[model samples]
Target: MSTTGLYQDQHLEINLPQAMVSVDEQRLILTRKEFELLAMLSANEGEILPRNVLLDRIWGYSEEIRTRTLDVHIRRLRKKLGLYGDSYIQTIFGVGYRFQRFREPRALISYQSPLFAATA
Candidate 1:
């Protein structure tokens, strides 16, 4: 459970009640299933959630059932997340998926000649 139904990190923010998601401060339009998937993964953070578990939690599917719903959703989510998708969502392979915490981009150091000369 997140505070005030909100899950937030350095690069992502999710409002559960509003069913809204934003990345790097930019809002993203997502489907209902997509939002739920992202919410669950992000909430768990670094914990790896197996396919069965995710299926059950998200779609009420049994472990024995074979389907590509999860995979499809994951792919869609990744594509929607852009560059941050792969960086944040990780595949366990033969297991499940996990949402990695977002990390702030490193600040770039300027090495302009004028600035360097002025400092010198």
Candidate 2:
């Protein structure tokens, strides 16, 4: 199995495993650390992973690394995600962040095709 996560849309796609991020009409590029941070957060979507946890998981630092580093990285990630970033990822006060599983409202579906149908 692959250890990559993908955040995509009609115009853009981010490949976490390849450490490549592509925006619409733009080139895909990212550093290793940036990709790692994004992958870790994305892997634990909807969980407000604390700063220490993120540092430990991504940087392998045990509560000793500067917290600002994490903050900086998160800010960068948010910028990279663009408009959809706010919808997918959220910051919890005094804690950390949560990657929300993008849930498209059923009402928005105009067709009843099987591909769009939900199965339990």
Output the number of the lDDT-best candidate: 1
CA-only RMSD, every prediction = 6.2, 9.2
Inter-residue clash pairs, candidate 2: none
lDDT of 1 by residue, 31-109 (tens): 9899899989977878999999999999999989999999999999998888888888899999999998777778999
Model 2 C-alpha lDDT per residue in residues 14-118, reported as the tens digit of each score? 676666666665764556777787777777766789988888888788876565888888887777777666766688888888877656546765668998788
Could you tell me the lDDT of residue 5 within candidate 2? 69
Question: Clashing residue pairs, candidate 1?
Answer: none
How well does candidate 2 score on lDDT at residue 41? 76
Q: What is the lDDT of residue 46 in candidate 1?
A: 87
Give TM per candidate: 0.79, 0.65
Off by over 4 Å in 2: 1-14, 23-27, 64-66, 103-120
User: How close to the true structure is residue 54 of candidate 2, measured as C-alpha lDDT?
Assistant: 88
